[model samples]
Target: MSPELIKRLTEHQPSLIGLEQCRQAAVLIPLLETPDGVQIVLEQRSPKLKHQPRDICLPGGAIEAGETPRQAAVREACEELLLRPEQIQVFGLMDVLHTNTLMLYPYAAKLTDYDMTYSTAEVERVFCVPLSFFQTQKPEQYRITLPVHPPEDFPLSRIVGGKQYQWRERREDIVFYQYQDWTIWGITAKILQAFARITR
Candidate 1:
């Protein structure tokens, strides 16, 4: 409308509109060089935890205030895996994933000098899966429909077809990978699938 407002708007950088309302988290897809081959480091959460207990996942957690996603990834790895910062070499950042309730940042890194140690309080145990397995194997995918339910107080009368108005439905695909006795699914499997595609 005004030249001043136009100039200010042009100078601003756009970001995700509602990201501030989402919980931010970061994860490190640690690559360990073993005699067999390059392996992926994964962890199983302690069953005693309140959320997602005993679920297999990457070494990461919520991003704290004033901490960058990269920093959060490294810190979570150090805390959960019982390693120092120097032991982990962060190579690159993967694509950012946006879910209904979370903004997830994944980083690809190499782990060195790790002796399979982990914090028992947060992690039940750690295991390695050959990266080649993901490179060669495909994950099983299933899609779920997401329908929006508008509030009853809304003015449906203003819309065409009134209460019968057809609202668009959204669908999301969930991936699953069965590796030995471990079952990797949900966000973790999705991330791994992306990583496999990128690396391949």
Candidate 2:
């Protein structure tokens, strides 16, 4: 990013900042490479989870008391996807973000293996999509619906050669690409958007 752009982004930091009433959640943005291009790890929540059941997400969870964000992210990734901390290379931290329901801190990581499995307890499925999809997209296509005021009917669109889709938020729906049977969405997509902008 240009210094000016970084400055502007930092000025907009309040929008990215999490709340002081935080629950200390952490997410790992796992990147991998294949002949197709660089890919990102994603997960589909179990249909049984009370919040956002069956929704697409990253391997993450609330940080236990005394646990650092890295510790929490590493532990959650291991427990959910059988991925060990030693197997992941930490990239860096992104700005904090919060929805009305939860405060989130996202960290980036690089994964070594393309082959992996998931535990059915919290994750229904695990998958990946090329990061190039975001390289060519814009954030305006994303929407923001307040938790207190959700849209009556959400709009859907096919993008990225039907490999990707989005559900309407405010003016835009969160961007998602289907990796195998898993659908990526929500804040996971937002974090991807931020990373794409920074890296591209």
Candidate 3:
């Protein structure tokens, strides 16, 4: 990550009151700069799960009762993708994110090899999309309806099967990526949005 990106991230402070009250979760927004460009890793959830089934998300899991959020983030990445903690360059921490269902700690990591293997039970696939997409795309491109107090709408997009899909927020920050046939809202988008704000 650039020093400018680091500086911007260091100064961020998103509200945590609501987050502290929910189940703690952590995710790593892994970054990689290829000949193609900077990319962010995302995972496609298996349709067999009961919660957030068929969603695009950062590799993560609920924080164990005894672990810190940072530890949870590193552990979840390792457990999900065999990403070793030593291989990651954790650039900076993002603001504490609150989903309607969980409190998420979003951490940033930069790695050279984004090689991944997925468990059919938890993840259906793993993929990467250029970070520039988020930086350059218009807000209208991601617009989608979300389930909120008043039923809100937001944009959603992610690379899957080598295609980009626009998602409509079906609720909160949760969106439905129709092309990939996955819902990507909640903690995942929250993490990406935080990165978008800092990188922009």
**lDDT against true structure, model 3:** 0.71
Which TM-score value belongs to model 1? 0.92
Best by lDDT: 1
Backbone clashes for every candidate come to 0, 3, 14
lDDT of 3 by residue, 75-109 (tens): 88877777677877887678877655677788888
Per-residue lDDT of model 2, residues 35-125, tens digit only: 8888877888899889998888889999998999888888888888888677888887887776655778888888876476888989888
Question: Lowest-lDDT window of 10 residues in candidate 1?
Answer: 92-101
Better of 1 and 3 by lDDT: 1
> Which pairs of residues collide in candidate 1?
none
Alpha-carbon local distance difference test for all models: 0.95, 0.75, 0.71
Candidate 2: worst 10 consecutive residues by lDDT?
154-163
TM-score of each: 0.92, 0.69, 0.68
The alpha-carbon deviation from the true structure for residue 99 of candidate 2, after best TM-score superposition, in angstroms, is 3.9
Cα RMSDs of all predictions? 1.7, 12.3, 14.1
Ranking by TM-score: 1, 2, 3
